[model samples]
Target: MASTVATNLNTLGRTTFIKNPSFKATPLNAYAKVLSKFCIIPSIEGPLKVVQQIEQQGAQTVLETVGLKKKGYAVKSHTLVKHNLATGQTGQVTAQDVSDAEYLAPVTIGSPGQTMNLQFDSGSSDLWVFSSEMPADQQQGVQSAGNSIFDPSKSSTFQRTHGTWSITYGDGSGASGNCGTDNINIGGITIKNQIIELADTASSQFLSGSESGLCGLAFPPLNTVKPTRAQTPMVNMISQSDIPKDSELFTCYFSGQSGNSYFTTGYIDHDACGGATPAYSPVDSSQGFWEVKSETACINGKAVSRSGNTAIVDTGTSLCLLEDSLLAALYGALPGAKIDHSVQGWVYPTDTPITSIPKLEIAVGSNYFTIEPEYFGFADLGNGYTYGSCQSRGSNFPFDILGDRFLCNIYAIFDQGKCQFGAVQRTSSGATTSGRPVDSGTESSTAQLVH
Candidate 1:
């Protein structure tokens, strides 16, 4: 059973070989082995597009151009490539506005390049995919996912480490395989000698989806690889001098519509921000998540009482889940909103005026980000017709989890260089709205459901 409430556990699953079930990060030995050396790789200047495609291999170097001062590391920004739209219907009801639950990009593995569409997640850290080693039934299940399987035997660059790998998610969905190193290409950026997990066994949750696998974007501490930990692709980029050393920042702009979401590495898009000033929040990476401190929340400009609230900001999740007491205070502020225990969330009449609903806002720093009525109410699921029941994009969780529903409206930046997370309202200029569906989960831990 896959939990609808997507978390790090749901994405990476549990690695059996690791003794400790709790979050424990091994020291990044790969950083020293890969990034310590500073070299000048020539840059290939081209028209500024979202994602730059690498036709010919350009030398990798730190970005030092006029207008941009020479900082710790040169920033390299990559526009997020959008995959195909995944569509379906629940009776007559269909979310034409939010057709997918997640976003995915193409990642080419091996020498000849068997490209697979992978969901880029910021929660868990592991790059596992369905491979040639999987059983026939398992391979068939995910056949449409990657298009073609990654057969290590055929690749000249494949180096088998023969290290066994396995991971089980909180929702019971999991994958396991052998570990090895190979070349992985994303957009125009290529990582050489990259460690990849070749899946031999896969659960239906993964096979049933259009996405072939997942690419983690968080710190290495949350990596699920066993025996010896593996370095994530993002770390490989920074260590290999593919990006700036002092510029370890990644920004995500996930849109409600398919093919509109995009992310940039190294640089922040000031134009897509609502305000010139961005609110910076400190992150506690000890939990292997971009966890930030949220002081309080407000509804319709009215203050809602709350103590110290810590929120895990994740792009992999679809809803804005809160604890029981905290959610009670939120929904209590709404006039017609009521707890629909069956869905483990709140619901309201679909015909209810969007503007009539009180606005929900969360305080990060000195600034506050509002969850607009159109973004917060989410989909209409109760009845198939025009207006029946509208589901609130919120659920109950032990700890607060801010998913894509809450994040899409804001410009989210994960800055490792300063060990802080920054946010601002998303501006439409230079920003896209296209996207694809990624991971789905259930209401409770181990329980599976989809939005």
Candidate 2:
């Protein structure tokens, strides 16, 4: 009577409590609280790399610098950390640091791809490739074949799907164009017939950085892309194969700026997932997002539990932020904990004594894990006047991100293809599925197939 996918659960069957039958499906479609914040409705869009840069900039001095000028509008500026590369894959924390590796180069109508990384993004649904269609004036500082733009003409999988796709990010950055196919090879996993949302915009505003193009990881209400002037990330991936369709969820490791990072598919590594494990909460199918049901939050060894809150596991977000009153109450437990609330939210002073901070724990699937006290301080918080704290956001009610900050403490898996998250606690003990030990702590596994 058991499904083949259910049977393939490996050791996780006995380890995780499958109290909710829906867990076997796809990721929990919890309502995305920030859905309305998406004024620019994603046609499809959008973390980390904060460590080595900080060390090179002098970790102490970097923390103290603040004063947001008119450099530009920033939706959210988080201190990105690091996540490790899977077993045989070689990963570089910062793209520049890995000069020798062959990065993914997206082509424009004008020429072929020059250099780029198979960047992994779960934030928005649109994908852009440098294009030759762009006016000659805007294409400076970058090189592409004359009128050839890194054409996918050579790849057998290459094809142009008619439609104009574009999307603007919360940060105001945007990209647009048509759709194309290519042989996407990364981490040794190749999706030979991968369908890519090729946004060959006449302009290159969004395509001007270390990143080349993005591989979207979101599943629904999100698949807006259409052949008739619309396209979706799900549509493209689904067309490629049923692999993405088999599951109900998809996740991004979202490791910040410390270690190397990559896009993990098929299942979530148990050990990589962090946060406390709480009693099984109900899933709100209508709400959307892989929303988990949690009854309360445990703050610093105290019972500061409450209900009606969802932690969004977005690869798009770089930092973790809880509600104001909740964070205050939580930080209230710490010594000399003064909150800087000049902005819509609050930020903790870096000089605050770390010892005074209580261990904050979040209970997820079947275990409870504590978020490191250091991750809470500003990148410079807790260090003296020499280091400056990083920027933060806490305006959203009951908002907390299970991002790289928390993930670094453990190995996690986003079984987005399936609605469940297979997390391995005590991963440092080496419980791994990638043929290696769970580098973080305890956890690791696989899903039959989904997304």
Candidate 3:
């Protein structure tokens, strides 16, 4: 029965497979991956403690750049500790390594179709890739990692443009490249002459990853192209005359079980929602994210309120991050749950029964959807502890972020034409039942979900 629903959802629209073939769900790895999405480099001091420090500082910089806070907002800085492998001692370090991405989807580019797996990020707004134009050493490293590199010379449809793009992370690592336009396709939906950033130089962090690049789904204003900003693929899809007016939206369904997650563009997967109507709230894209108001929450069926709070629905992030007070309140309700500084997040004994975890519900507009208890435990921290999915957004970040941890429990919709975000609860019989990871197979493309 579940297989039938999954098939029906895939067939209803242009769908793309979502998977992280190399990702392992360890607490350190999960936390590091989430930090990398925010451009934060995890420190070698310790897994959890350093991540918390880095996030506090990095979030402040990000919030300030987006105009969410005053330029000189007071932010505490932590000295990054670097361990010397040979000396077995820790010292101050300038840079830290990035973790592997959580998920990636196949995107076809150019005339003959050069398909590369890209990390689809809703929190950002740039579609950039490692290209053939990069330095030989960098290209070889990226290629050796089983990642595809785009060669503009091979694609007859590719056209070079005047703009240049560069993105630097907090750790001094960055990517810089030239710009071009070509036919780009995802889930069988093609957008011609879409702006593509071809990286000629990339940091080692990006070159070692399985993903070729990133497909940012946020608003156009967030695009980082120099001199003149370019429209993102999502924006181009909406403006293109070839795409139908009603087909301007995209939906994401992430399964708890591997090999089942898929993304659909051009229509909603009603079957994935189990006949429940999606409740939507107007988006505030001024800050260039899928932002919506979410001021209320319920923990263990008890009302918890915070006025004027908003959340960014970001699929790129691995865990659901909320304000510290909200996190304290939620975790406080669960017996044995405590803020474990060792992991720099809330955690409980691994032996605790699932029924013992308190119920948590977050609001989307006026409607509140319950987050299944199965998602309560995020990653396993060896030594009899399990990290909680709900973590502190910290003092620096201005808004709460609803990442895959919260997203897995619902059928999410990103309506570009309407400028709103919507979601509906998934029925018990849905493709995924928990946040636990399952063994996955090798990557493959399927037309079963394509329009």
Top model number, TM-score: 3
Tens-digit per-residue lDDT, 1-451, candidate 2? 1001222333221121111111111000111112212321111111112222221121111101221111231223223222232333222223221111111223222123233343333434444555555555535423531222345654455777655555542222345556665555333234444455554553242333334455444443343345442333334334555233453233333233333443433333333433323122233222233345443445544544445445544444334544444565665676555533212123455556767656665555324555655555434323332111112233322334454456544444445433454443333333322221212233223111110
How well does each candidate superpose onto the true structure, as a TM-score? 0.68, 0.58, 0.84
Task: Go through the candidates in order and give each one's C-alpha lDDT.
Answer: 0.54, 0.37, 0.71
Task: List model 1 lDDT by residue over 1-451, tens digit each.
Answer: 0001112222111111111121111111111101111111112111111233232122211111111122232323322111222322111111111122256667888888888767676766778777889999878766754345778888888899956666543222357888999998765566799899899887665576556777777676666666776888877877877645555666777766544666666556545563345567788776466778765556565554445657767766555655455455556666676754323245566666766666666665435676766676655654521111112212212235576767866877787667788776653343322111111221223211111
RMSD of each: 18.6, 15.2, 9.5
Winner on TM-score between 2 and 3 is: 3
- Scored by lDDT, the top model is 3
lDDT of 3 by residue, 1-451 (tens): 0111233334234655657767766564555555544543332234323222433443222322355442233323333234444466664322234456677899999989999899888988889999999999999999899999999998999999998887654443568888999998888778999989999999786888878999989887777786787898877777875444665677888877556788877677656766656777799988788999887777765666666788899988878888777777777777788876556678888898878887787877666766787777888788788898887665455677898888888888898888888777764456422121111211222111110
> In model 2, where do residues sit more than 4 Å from their true spots?
1-115, 141-150, 153-156, 202-207, 227-260, 267-288, 341-345, 349-353, 365-367, 381-399, 426-451
Q: Which sequence of candidate numbers ranks them by lDDT, best first?
A: 3, 1, 2
Deviation in Å, model 1, residue 82 alpha carbon: 33
Candidate 3 residue 287 Cα shift, in angstroms, is 0.6
Residue pairs with clashing backbones, model 3? none
